[model samples]
Structures are given as structure tokens and as C-alpha cells.
Target chain A: MINDVWILATASLVAISCALVGVFLILRRQALMGDAISHSVLLGIVLAFLISESRSLPVMLAGAVIIGLITAWLSDTLHKVGKLQSDASIGIVFTLFFAIGVILISLYAGQVDLDQECVLYGEIAFVPFDTIIWGSSEQGLDIGPRAFWMISVVFVIVLASILVAFNRLQTVAFHPSLALSLGINVVFWHYFLMTLVSLTTVASFDAVGAILVVALLVIPASSAYLLASTLKNMLWLAVIYAQSAVLIGYALAYALDSAISASIAVTSGVLLGLTILGLQVHKIRLRRQGKATLLEKA
Target chain B: MQEWNLIQQPGTWELLIEFWSFEDMNALWVLMGSILLGMSASVIGGFAFLRKRSLIGDALAHAALPGVMMAFLLFQTRDPLVMFLGALTSSFIGFFLIDWLPKNTKIKPDTALAITLSFFFALGLMLLSHIQGLQVENKSGLDKILFGQAAAMTQQDITLLAYVTVFILVAVTAFFQKFRLIAFSAIYARSLGVPVALYELLLALLIVMSVVVGLQLVGVVLMAAVLLTPIAAARFWSDQLTTILFLSAFFGALSALISTQISYLAPAMPTGPWMVVSLASLFLLSLLFAPSRGLIKRYWQQRQLRQKVSEENVLRTLYKLYERRQFEQNDFNIADIQALRSMPTDMLKDTLKHLCKKQMIRESMRGFCLSKEGLEIATQLTRRHRLWENYLNQYMDLPADQVHSQAERIEHILTQEQEWQLEAELKNRKSDPHGNPIPENTEGMSRDK
Candidate 1:
């Protein structure tokens, strides 16, 4: 029972952190950037593991940030210098990086802490087993779940960054030239948001793998963007939506005997579909009411 | 002992010999299959690249996964044909959703693609996990589809891939012109009374077919790279669509040959990444070194143009110096020329040396002098410069002084024919408005008396 509690908490924390960064991505119309970063970070993990000979969090996160920045920079260069289409550049760079990661993992299969399977769909059920103790066995501190702690730290950092630079991020996303005119350092904010995304994606990888992290990062914020009118409201709504997906998806996964991460993605997708349908229905009702009022007044 | 045996196993050279001798027919079949896959994918993918729908191949690949898992769950079989049909059905549906969503909804195309891709992939993951829970025989290896093992490809799989490759190639050939029309401009094709919508759907269908066939080898995640990278690299080599298509196929085939060989030698290495890495290497090579559009070529051209412009500027300056002396003096100090154009002394020296090598300029007792041929070239440069300045002043209505700076850059680029056109257009004007004489085009040592 406690293990299930830890799992739910870890998954929810992961979902919330992803949704927080995803709001900016949706506003910037860079929804696929998360997808690109998440996949290429696998290479980072394998390389870090190879070099450090350990599965420590800081080393993995450091490697992930480096590769994530490279993916972003390389894609931008390909678009500007190579004159390739923006989307094609993104597709090529990420896939090439990801393929390299896969090759490395397979070639040094036993030497690394990862397998190809776990990289694709992570083993989140094993989260509770890997505990981080704070002291001796006689009087030790059980830190709950390592994934939970990692997601918590990532969530705090992302939230604080957003709160601290909310205006700059908003101006940069909506009007980069205006941000520049306002002396906002628009490029710095752009990389700032990307840093948060890389950090959140790597932290969440232990719980949801790389592919489903793309889902967690994109779906909720996109759904909220469709419904909410303001940026602040969208952020809140996305968090709520993501948290609801986690709870409901956990239950659904329990009932159906399916993967928890996949279930969460399915729930998010279904909710988005419902929101689309509901918005359409609301517009139709408003139109009918407007027509009746006009006829009666006439 | 076990580790020792593993380390003592046959090395790469031995494996290469075996691969060449065809001692392992499996390797031969895998190689042949990859070659066909490469050729057909790149040919069909050309249209996708041109239309800027490169990522659509990615979405289709992801969307096909659910159908493959569904087929397996239903039939309890791993028949390639069954999986192919299932993947095709889902891919078509996905293509439709990606096409239809943006047209009908507030959601943009990229968002729609992301949603559809993740939605279907999530479904596939769900089903796959269920299959895992069932503990059925052979369920252990089903995860291999995610990253694809070429060694796992059977003889039947290769045969199926061959037939699909032939079908895709023939279809693309038959509809080549129509595909080209839609890819270039759908609205224009519609204005021409072509069935644009039908051809668009046909092209999407072709993308789906190629993506599905290559899925087992390249897997769902990286299949789009196989579909798109060859054409991207080939684009650096040619602007003509036909040549690009041909070159794309050749690159695809070549990468497949090398990657397959590597995979055969190192059984531990998977084929998909090796294929993708090889293709990416080819792309980087073309991006850096292809003759026409490569970075090195463009850089070289720019460098040559810079050198030529500076050289020409020096000769024009020498002519102006002669004019300053009222046409009596034929040589000027190097420092005087340097004062005229604020240039590096070393660059000026090299420019002077280059002119001397070409017999355009010679070192005088004071500094530098224009040779007879050099004087004629300098006269033409000065004439072109002054004429452009006059044209800009009279037609463009600019101040004569402002025109000099504008005309300075244009003088190097204007051809002799353009100079004549300028002369005629300006109605035989012999002198610029700034009171500078525009000399006639002369040869050898000839000068106006």
C-alpha cells in the first residue's frame, strides 16, 4: 500500500513539473522541442553512466543538459545555415542523436545501467526499491522515493524560475522584438525555458521514460491553451489537468492492467478530445441563445 | 573462462571474410533487404522533403505502432503481412487526422501531429504492456520492434520487404509528375485543373507505404530519419528534382551497404542506428563538401570574390592617382594608395604582388606603377565606375558624391555588356557630373589623345 502511494506521488510530481514547462512551449508553439530533448537525453544518460561508472542523479542531469543544449543549438544552426526547413532540422538532429544513444547502449549493454527497453518505456515500478538513506542503519532517514525527491527539486526550480522571470518569459514568447526593446534579454529567457525543460525531462525519465515524457509535456498544456484565455490561468489549468490525469490514469491502469505511463497519456489525450468537444458545444449554445434574443427583440 | 571465451571469439576481419564468402546466407539476405529498403524509401521520401512534410513520416511511423500491437494481440501471430496491413490502416487514419485537424479546428498542424502521434503511441504501449502481462511464449522478444534487430529479420521478412519495395517504386514512377506538381504548389496545381486533393492523398499513401515497410528494420522512432535524411543530403548536390531523387537513392543504398556490413561484423550492434549514423555521416559530408551548395564551396567562392574586388579596387585607385597628377605621373607611392582606401598594408602588398604576377602592375622606384595592360584595365574600371555614378545621379537622382560609394561596389560586378547598356542609356555621356572624365574602353597601351 505504501509502495503504491509512493508510485502515485512520484508520477503526479513528474506530471506537474512537465506541465509547468509545457505551458511556455505551447505558447511559443515549440511543442516538439520537448520531444526532441527527451529522446536525445538518452545519449546523455548512457555517456554519463559510461564516464562516471555510476547512476548518480547529478552526473546524469549534467550530461542531459549538455546534450539538450547541443540539440537545440544544432537544430537552429541547421535551419539558419544549412537552409533546411525548421521542422526537418529538428527531426534530423534529434533522431541522429537518439540513434547514437541506442547504438551506444547496445554496444556497451552490460557496462551501462540502462537497457534499450527501459530507455523506451522506463521501469517506474522499481522506483521504491532504490532508496536513498540519510544515516546509519540504526538511525537512518528514509527519504521516501528517490524519484519523488528528484521530481520535487526539479518542480521547485522550474516554478521558481517561472515566477522570477514570468514577465520576461511572457514577452519573449508573445513578442520577441518587444522583449528586446524592453531590455529583457530575450535570448537568455529562451535558453532559460529550455534549461527548465531539459531538467524536468531528465528528472521525469525515471518515472515515465523518454517517449511518454513528450506526452506529459505537450498534451496538458495544449489542452489548457485551447480553453484558457490567459497565461497564468493556462499554467494552473494545465497543472490541474495533469494531476487529474495522474489520479484517474493510475486507477485506469490498475483496472486494465496496463502501463501506468501509457494510461496517463491516454487519459490526457481523451480529456483534450473532450475539451474540444465541450468548447464546440458551448459555442453552439451561445449562438442559439443569441438568435432567440434577436428574434424576440425584433 | 566464459569471459575469456567471449574475448577470444572471432574478430571483425574474420566476420568480414565470412560475410563476403556468403558463408552466412542470413547476412547476405539482410544486406539485400536493406539495399532495397533504402532505394525505395529515399525515392518516395523525395516528395515528402520537397513538400516540407518531413515530420509527417515521423507521425505516421509512431501511429503505426498501435496497429502492429493490435494485430498481434488479436491473432496471436507475428506474421509480417498481418502487421503490415494493420500498420497501414492506422497510418492512413493518422495521415487523415493530421490532414483534417488543422483545417477543422483551432489546433495547429504541429499540435495535431503531436497529439495524434502520442495518442496512438500511448495506445500501442498499453497493448504491449498487456501482452507482457499475459506471459505468452515469444513475448520476450516483442520489444525488439522498438529498436529493431536486423538479425531477427527472417527470410520471409526479406521477401515481403522486396515486394513492397517494388510496389512503392512502381507507384512513384507512374505518378511522378503529379506528385511533383502537388509537392511544388498545390494551389497552382488546383488552378491547372489537376485533382490536387487526390494526388495529395496519393502522396500521403506512398509515404505511409514506405514508412511501414521500413519500420521493422529502422523501427518506429527512427524510421523518419531513414525516410528523410537521404533526400536532405542529396538536396545539397542538385537543384533538379530528378537528380536529387536519383542521388538520394544512391546515398541511401550506399549507407545501407556499409551499415549492414558493420552490423554483420558486430552482432551486438543493431542495424537501425548504424544505418542512421551512416546516413547522417553522408549528410554531414555533403553539407560540408558538396561542390555547388556545400559550405566549403560557398566559402571558397566568397573568398575569391573578396580577393578579386580588392585587386580591382587597387587598379582603380592607381588610375585615380594618375588623374590626380593630371595624367603626367604613371606611378604613385604605396602609402598614397593606402590613404585612398583604408586597407591593411599586408593585404595591399599581396594585391600588388598578385597584379605584378599577372603583368598588370610593376614596382617602380617610388612604389607601384600600372603596366600598359594594367593602365587599359584600370581605365575600363574607372569608366565603369564613373558611368554607374552618372547613371545613378541622372536616373536614380542621387547626389554625385553619394553615388561614388554606391558605384564602388557595383563597378566590380557590372559586366562589359552592362557598361555598354549604361553608356547607351545615359546617352553617350563622356564625363560624370562630378567633372571626372569617363574614359573609353581601351586595349593594350592605347589612350585618348
Candidate 2:
């Protein structure tokens, strides 16, 4: 039962952190950038292992963030300077990075402990086993799951960054040129948001893996985009949606005896579908009311 | 390090020799499967690349995962046909969702693609995990579909891959022109009485089929590279769709051959990543070194143009200085030329030296003078410039002052035929709008020289 709580807490923290940064991604129309970074960060992890010869968390996070930035910068350069189409540039960059990561893993299969399967779907079920104990082994206090603590730090950081730079991020995301004219560093904010995204992705890697991290980043924010009229509301609503997905998805996974992370992603997708359906129904009802009012006047 | 040591082993040569000689039937089958998969994916992917839907293959591949899992759960078998059909059905549904969401909802196409891709992939993972927990037969290799293990492929898998790939290739060839039309301009194709919607459906089906079959080799994660990079590289080599299609197929086949050979030699190295990495290398090569459109070639061409333009501008500047002297003096130093038109001292010297090397200018103690050939060329340039200025002044209603800068750029590019047309349009005007004598059209004289 305690194991279940840690899983849900870890998943919710990951979802909220991802959705917090993802709202800006949606606002900037760069949701696919989230997808691209998630994939390419695999290369960073592999490279980090190769260089450091250790599986330390800081080294992996640093490597992943740096590669994530490079992925963003390189794709942007390919789009702008190389004159490749945006989607093709993104497709080329991320796939190439992922392929290199896979190759490195295969070539160094003896040294690298990571496997392609764990990198793809992740093993969220094992979260409770990897606990962090404070103090000495004799009387150490068991804090929580290591993943839960890592994600909590990331969540606090993300929440702090958003709070501190809310208007600047909002202006840059909505009107980049106007923000530039107003003396806000658009490029800085762009990378700032990208950094937040990278941090969130790396932190969530333990629970959701790489690809499904994109599901968490894109779906909740996109659903909120459909419903919320303001960025603040969208941010809050996205967090709400992400939390609910964790709760419902955990229950679903428990009932079906399936993977929790995948179930969470599925739940988020279902929630987005329901949001779309609800909006459509609301529109039809509103149109019917308009027709009724016109007919009564006639 | 181990990989390098293995490469140095004497046994590695025998493995390479065995791979090429087809001694190992498994290697042969995997090689054939990858080659066919590469060719067909690249050929069909060209249209998607051209249509700018390069990432749709990725979405469809992810969307196929659940279908594969569902097929396994339903049939309790791993029949290639059942898996293929399951993947195709789900991929088609994904295609429809990607097509529908952007049109009907406020979600942009990229977001729609992300949503469909991740949602389906997550759902598929869910189903796959559930299958993994169940005590089912042949569920062991089901996870291989995620990253694909070519060595695990059986002969039946190869046969199924062959049929699907060949069918895709034939369909693409049979409907080449129609596909080309729709890819380039669907609205134009529709106006010409083509049933664009039906053809689009056909194209989407072909894409999904190739993507489905390719899942067992290239896998889902990097399949988009196989579909996009070859065509992107091929684009640098050619402009026409036919040439691009052939070149992309060739690249695809070549990458497949190389990757399959490497995987057969190293066994631990997967075929899919090697294939994609080799393809990306090809893309890098084409991006840098392809003849006309490649970056290096374009940079070289631009440098040459800059040299030629600067050289001509110096010649024209020297001619203008000579004109300031009422055509008596044919020579002037760098200072005199700079007085008329400013240029860097070193650049002016370089331009003058190149002109001298071309025998268009003579270097003496006084400065530089136009040779007979150079004078004739200068006369022609001046005539074209002044004639353009006159034409612009008369037809475009520009003031005399504004025409010089406009003519300055047009003079170098104005062809002889254009000069004659401009002169005729200006009605044989002798003086420019600036009241300077338009140098006589020395075309016949320059040819004589």
C-alpha cells in the first residue's frame, strides 16, 4: 500500500512538472520540440555514461540537459540556416541522435547498464524499491522513493521559475517580436523554457521514460489549451488534468495489472479526447439555443 | 574498445566473407529484408517528404503498436499477417485522426500528430505490459517490435516483408505520375479532374503499409529517419521527382547493405540504428558535397560570383574615371578609381591584378588602363548601364538621380539581347537621363576585337 502511494506521488509530481513547462510549449507552438528533446536526451544519457563511467544522477541530468539544448539549437539552425522544413529538420535531428544512442549502447553493451526497453517504456513499478535512506544504515530514516524526491526537487524548481518569470515567458511565447521590441530577451526565455523542459524531462525519466515523457508534456497542456482562455488558467488546469490522470491511470493499471506509466499516458489521452468531445457537444447545444431564440422571435 | 579489437580479429574477415557469400542463411534473409524495406520506404517516403508530412510515418508507426499487441492477445499467435493487418488498421485510424483533428479542432497539425502518436504508443505499451503479465505463448518476442531485432526474424517474416515491400514498390511505380501531381500540388491536381482525395487515401495506405512492415526491422522510434533522411539527401542531388526517387532508393539500399553487413559481423549491433546512422551520414554527405544545391557547392559558387562581380565593378569604375577625363586618358591609379567609387585598398588591388591576369586591363607605372578587349567590354557595360537608366527614367518615371544606383546593379546581369531590347524600347536614345553620352552599342566591334 505504501508502494502504491509512492508510485502515485512520483507519477503526479512528474506529470505536474511536465505540464507546467508544457503549457509554455503549447503556447509557443513547440510541443514537438518537447518530443524531440525527450528522444535525443537518450544520446546524452549514453554519452554521460561513456564519459563519466558512472550512473550518478547529476552527471546524467547535466548530460541530458546539454544534449536537449543542442537538439533545440541544432534543429532551429537546420530550419533557419540550412533551410530545411521544420518537421523534417526535427525528424532528422532526433532520429539521428536516438540512433547514435542505440548504437553506443549496443557497442558498449557490457559497460552500459541501460537497455532499450527500459529507455522506451520505463519501469515505474520498481520505484518503491529504490528508496533513499537518510543518515547511517543503523538508524537511518527512510525518506521516500529516490524518484519521488528527484521529481519533487524538479517540481519546486519548475514552479519557482514559472512564478518568477510568468509575464516574461508569457509575452515571449505569445508575441516574440513584441517581446523583443519591449527589451525582453526572447532567445534567453526560449532557452530558459527549453532548459526547464529538459530538467523536467530528465527528472521524469525514472518514472515515464523518454517517449511517454512527451505524452505527459503535450497531452495535458493541449487539453487545457482546448478549454482554458487564459495562460494562468491553462497552467492550473493542466496540472489538474495531469494529477487526475495519475490517480485514474494508477487505478486502471492496478485493475488491469498493467504498466502504470503507460496507463497514465493512456488516461491523459482519454481525457483529451473527452475534452474535445465535450467542447463539440457544448458548441452544438449553444448553436441549438441560438436557433431556438431566433425561431421564437420570428 | 572491444568492438575495435573484434574488428582486428582474423575471424572477422571470415565473417565478412561469409556474410557477403551468403553462407549464413539468416544473414541473407535479414539482408534481403532490410534492403527491400529500405528501398520501398524511401520510395514511398519521397512523396511524404515532398508533401511536408515527413513525420507522419513516425506517428503511424507508434500507432501500429497497440494493433500488434491486440492481434497477439486475440489470436494467441505471432503470425506476420495478423500483426500486419492489426497494425495497418490502427495506423489507418491514426492517419485519420491526424488528418481530422487539425481540420475539426483548434489543435494544430503538429500537436495532433504528437497526441495521436503518444496516445497510441502509450495505449500499446499498456496492452503489451498486460500481455507480458499473462502466461501466454510467443508473447516473449512481442516487445522486440519496439526496437526491432532483425536477427530474431524468421524466414516467414522475411517472406511477408518481401511481399508487402514489392507490392508497395509496384503500386508506387504504377501510379507515379498521379502521386507526383498530388504531392506537388493537390489543388492543381484536383482542378485537373484528378480525384485527389482518393489518391491521397492511396498514398496514406502505402505509407502505412511500408511503415507496418518496417516495424520488424527499423522499429518504431527511428523509422521516421528511414522515411525522411534518404529523400532529404536525394533532394540535394536532384530536383525532378523521378531522379530523386531513384537516388533515394539507391541510398536506402546502400545504407541497408552496409548496416546489415555490420550487424551480421557484430551481432550485438542492431541493424536498425546502423541503418539510420548510415542513412544520416549519407544525408550529411549530400548536404555538404552534392553538386549544385549542397552547402559547400553553393558557398563556392557564391564566392566565385562575388569575385566576378567585384572585378567587373572595378572595370566599370575605371571606365567611369576615364569618362571623367573626357575619354582621353585611358589609365588611372587606385586613388583615382577610389575617388569615383569607394572600395577597400586590398580588394581594389586584387581586382586589378585579376583583371590584368584576364588580359582585360594593362598594368603600367601610371596606374591601370583598359586594353582593347577591356575597352570594348567597358564600352558595352557602360552602354547597357546608361541605356537601362534611360529606359527606367522614361518608362518607370524615375528621376535622373535615382537611376544610377538602379542601373549599377542591372548593368552586370543585363544580357546583350536585353540591352538591345532596352535600347529599342528607349527609341535609340543617345544621351542618358543624366545628360551623359550613352556609349555606342559596341557589340559588333567587341566581337571583332
Candidate 3:
């Protein structure tokens, strides 16, 4: 039972980080860019492990950030310079990056602790065993799962960035040219937001792996985008959806003994479907009420 | 790091050579499968890219995951045909959802794509996990579809790939003109009664088929790249749709060849990413070096234009200098020429040398002089420049000052026909709005040293 709590905690933090950044991504119409960054960061993780010869958290995060920025920059270059359409450019860059990552992992299969399967589905259940220690062996304090703390830190950073830059982010997300007119550096904000996404994705990747991170990043925010009218409401609602997904996904996985990360992704998707259905129901109810009042007046 | 040295083993090169020689039957099958996958994907993907629905492949590929799992669950067999039908059905469902969502709700197409993609992928993952937990035989290989395993292609898989490839190619060829019409101008095609929506549905079906066929090799996540990138790269090579489709298919086949060889040589390396990487390499190559629309070619053309503009500016400046000197002499010092055009000394010297090489100008120890040929060419240029200035001044209603800058840009680009049109529009006036005399035509003038 305690183990489930840690798993759910870590999953919630991962969800929060992804959802916070994902709100801006969906609003800025860069949902696929999140997908691209999540995929390419695998290459970063592989390279980081290879270069550092160890799976140090900071080293992997740094590598993920650099590669994430490269993916964003290269995709932008392909769109702007190569004259490819935005979707094609994105499709080309991330797949190429991800393929390289997969190739590297396969080539150095034994040297790197990462495997193809782990890179795909992730081993979030095992995350609890990788505890962070605070002192010497004699009096070391367990601070719970390292992934939990890592994602929590990232969640806070994402929250602070959004909270501090809300207006600028909202302006940039809603209307880039308008933001530019308002003296916001559109490119800087784009990359800054991307940096946050990269950080969030890398932190979540330890718990959910590469592909499932995309689910966490896009699904909650998409549901929120459907449900909420304001960006503020959307962010809060995304957090709500993400937390609910974590808890319910944990319960489903616990019952079925399935892959926890995938279960979480599935649970969130189910939540999104329900959200869509509910929104439709609410809309129909409002229409019926409006018609009834109109008929009474008539 | 020691693992990296395996490539340097004594027989590694020999193994690569043998693999590329197609002596190995497994290698040959994988090669055939990849080639068919590439060709079909690129050809059909051409239309998808044209319609700006390139990401539909991504969504469909991801959506096919659940279908494959469902096929395995229902039939308890890894039959390629069953899986194909299942993936086709599932992706069609996904395609309709993607099509319906944006129309029915306020969700945009890209958002719709992301939603369908992640949702279906999650469902697939959930099913796969449950399947894995069930301890089913042959369950392990199903995960390979996420990243693709070319070595996993049985003879049956190859046959399936070939059939689908042939089907897609035949259908696309038969409907070539109609597909092209709908892709390029759907509203216009509809007005002409071409049944645009039916064609769109057919194209979607074709995309779903190609994606399903290629899924075994390229996998779900990167399938869209295989479909779209080759066509995008091929676009740099040609403008004609037929040529683009041909080049795209060729690029796809070529990448498949290279990726399959690498996968064969290094068994540890997966074929799909290598295929993607190879495709990207070709795309980068096309983007950089294709003759017509390539980056290098565009750069060279720009440089050529800059040189021509500079050379013409020098000629115009020389004529102005001759005019300022009251048309008394043809020779002028390089410094005086520099003072007139604000050009760097060395660059101006090179232009002068180039002109002299062409025998358009004569260079003496003291100064530079336009030969008779140069004078005639320079006179024609000056007349065009002045005529364009007058045209812009008269027709665009710009002041004389503003017209000079406008004519300065237009003079270099104006064709002979446009020059004549400007002359006629200006009623063959001898003088411009600023009252500078437009030099008359000096045909039949002989060159002099």
C-alpha cells in the first residue's frame, strides 16, 4: 500500500510537470513539438549515458535539454530554411533524432543501462527502489524515490515559470505577433517554454519513459483545453485531470498487473473521452434550457 | 566503448560485403520488404503532403497499434494478413475520428491528431501490457512494431508488403490525374465535378494501407517520417507531380536499400531508424545540392544575381560618369568610378577585369574605357534603366526620386519584352521624369580596343 502511494506520488508529479507545460503547448499550437521533443530526448539520454559512462541524473537532464533544444532548433530550421512545411519538418527531424537514439542504444546495448524496452514503456514501478540518500550509510535519510523528487522539482519550476510569466506566456500562446507587438521576445519565449518542456519531459521520462511522456504531456492538457474557458482554469483543470489519472491509473494497474505508465496513459485518455462526452452533454443541456425559455416567452 | 570495437572485427567487412551481395536469403527478403515499403509510402505520401495532411500518417500509424494487438488477441496468430486487416480497420476508425473531431468540435486538426495519436497509442500500450502479462506465446515480438524490426519480416510479410505496394502503386497510377487535381485544387476539382470527397476518402484509405503495410518495417512512431520525408526531399528535385512521385519513390527505395544493408551487417542495429536516418540523409542531400531548387543552387543563383547587379551598377555608373563629363571621353580613372558607385576598389577592379576579358572594356595604365561594344551594351542598359524609371514614375505615379530606386531593382530583372512594353507605355519618350536623356538604341555598333 505504501509502495502504491510512492508510485502515485511520482506519477502525479510527472503528470503535473507535463500538464503544466502541456497547457502552454496546446495553447501555442505546439502540441506536436512536445511530441517531437519527447522523442528526441531519448537520443540525448543515450548520448549522455554514453559520454558520462554513468546514468547520473544531472548529466542526463543536461543532455536531454541540449538535444531537446537541438530538435526544436533543427525542426525550426527545416521549416524556415529548408522550405519544408511545418509538419513535414517536424516529422523529419524528430524521427531522425529518435532513430539515431535507438540505433545508438542497440549498438551499445551492454554498455548503457538503458534498453529498447525500457526506453519505450518505462519501468515506473522500479523507480521507488532507486532512492535518493541524504547522508552516510550509518545515518542516511531516505527522501523517498529519486524520480519523485526530480519530478516534483521540475513541477515546481514549471509552475513558477508559468505563474511568473503568465501574461507573457498567455499572449505568446494566444497570439505570437500580438506578443511581439507588446515587446515580448517571441523566439526567446518559445525556446524558454521549450526548455521547461524539455526539463519536464526528461524528469518524467525516468518514471514514464519517452513515448508515454508524450501521453502525459498532451492528454491532460487536451482534456483541460476542452473543459476550461480561461488559460488559468485550463492549467488548474489539467492538474486535476492529471492527478485523477495518476490515482485511477494506479488503481487500474494494481488490479490488472499491467504496465503502470501505459495504464496511466490509458486512464488519462479515458478521462479525456469522458470530458468530451460531458462537455457535449453540458452544451446540449444549455441549448435545451435556452429553447425552453424561448418557448415559454413565445 | 569496447563494444564499439566489434565493428572492427576481422570478418565484419566480409559479413557486410556478403550481406550487400544478397547472398543471404533473409537479407534479400528484408531488402525486398523495405523497398516495397519505401516505394509505396513515398508515392502515396506525396498526395498526403500536398493536401497538408502529412501528420495523418503519424496518427494512423499510432492508431494501427491497437488494431494489431486486437488482431493478436482475437486470432492468437501473428498472421500478417489478419494484422493488416485489423490495422486497416483501426486506422480507418482513427482517420474518421481525426476527420470528424475538428468538424464536430472546436478542436483544431493538429490537436485532433495529437489526441487521436496519444489516445490510440495508450490503448494499444494498455492492451499490449495485458497481453504480455497473459504470458502468450510470440508476444515478445509484438513490441517490435513500435520501433519496427526488418529482420522480423517473414517471407509472408514480404509477400504482403509486395501486394500492398503493388495495389497502392496501381491505384495511384490509375487515379493519377484525379488525385493530382484534388490535391492541388480541391475546390476547383469539386466544381469540375470530380467527386473531391470520394477521392479524399480514397486517398485516406490508400494512406492507411501504405501505413499498415510499412508498419512492420518502419513501426508506428516513425512511420509518418518514412511516408512524408522522402516526398519532401523529392520536392526539391522537381515541380512536376509525376516526376516528384517518381523521385520520391526512388528516394524511399534507396533509403530502404541502405538501411537494410546496415541492419544486415550489424544485427544489433534496427532497420527502421537506419531507414529513417538514411532517408533524412537523402533529404538533407536534396535540400543542399539539388540543381534547381536546392540550397546550394539557390545560393549560387543569388550570388550570380548580386554579381550581375553589381556589374550593371558599375556600367550605369560609368555611363553617368561619361554623362557628367558632358560625353567628352570614354575613359575614366578607377577612383572616379569608385566615387560614383560607392563600390570597393578590389571588387570594382575584378568587375573591370571581367569586362575587359569579355572585351566589353579596355584597360590602360591610366584608366578604364568602354569599348564600342561596351558602350552599346551600356547604352542599352542605361536606356532600360531610364525607361523603367519613367514607367514607374508615370504609371505607378511615383515621384522621379522614388522611381530611380524602383527602376534600379526592376532594371536588372526586366525581360526584353517588359523593356519594350515599358517603352511603349512611356510612348517612346527620349527623356525620363528627371529630364535625363534616355540613350537611343545603338545596334550594329562595332567593338574596339
- The regions of model 2 sitting more than 4 angstroms off are A1-6, A55-58, A80-82, A128-150, A180-188, B1-10, B428-435, B443-449
Say what the interface RMSD of candidate 2 is. 2.2
**Best model per TM-score:** 1
> What are the per-residue Cα lDDT tens digits for candidate 2 across A44-133?
989999999976678878998899999999999888856789989999999999999988877777788777777877778898998888
User: Model 1 over residues B294-368: C-alpha lDDT tens digits?
Assistant: 999999999999999999999999999998998898878888998888889999999999999998998898988
Per-residue lDDT over A1-298 for candidate 1, one digit per residue giving the tens place of the 0 to 100 score: 8999899999998999999999898778787777888889888888888989987778878988898888988988999989999888988899999999988877777677677767766767888887778789668998787778888889899989889988888888889888889888877777777788889988998888888888888889888888888889999999999999999988988888989889998899888889888988998999999999999999
| Clashes per candidate, residues 3 or more apart or on different chains | 0, 0, 0
Docking class of 2: medium
Predicted structure with the largest lDDT when compared to the true one: 2
Instruction: Give the whole-model CA lDDT for all candidates, comma-separated.
Output: 0.85, 0.89, 0.87
Model 1 chain A scores worst on lDDT over the 10 consecutive residues at A112-121
lDDT of 2 by residue, B1-449 (tens): 23433555579878877777887888898888899999999999999998999899999999999999998899998999999999999999999999999998889899999999999999999999899899977788787777766877889999999999999999999999999999989999999999999999999999999999999888888788899999999998887889999999999999989887886777666678888899999999998999988899999999999998898788888888889889898879889889888899998899899999999999876989999888888888888889988988988999999999989898878886787788778876789998999887654664323
Q: Show pairs that collide, candidate 1.
A: none
TM-score of 1: 0.94
> Comparing only chain A of model 2 with the true chain A, what is the TM-score?
0.96
Question: Which segments of model 1 are wrong by more than 4 Å?
Answer: A135-140, A181-184, A284-298, B1-8, B444-449
- Compute DockQ for each candidate against the true complex: 0.58, 0.64, 0.65
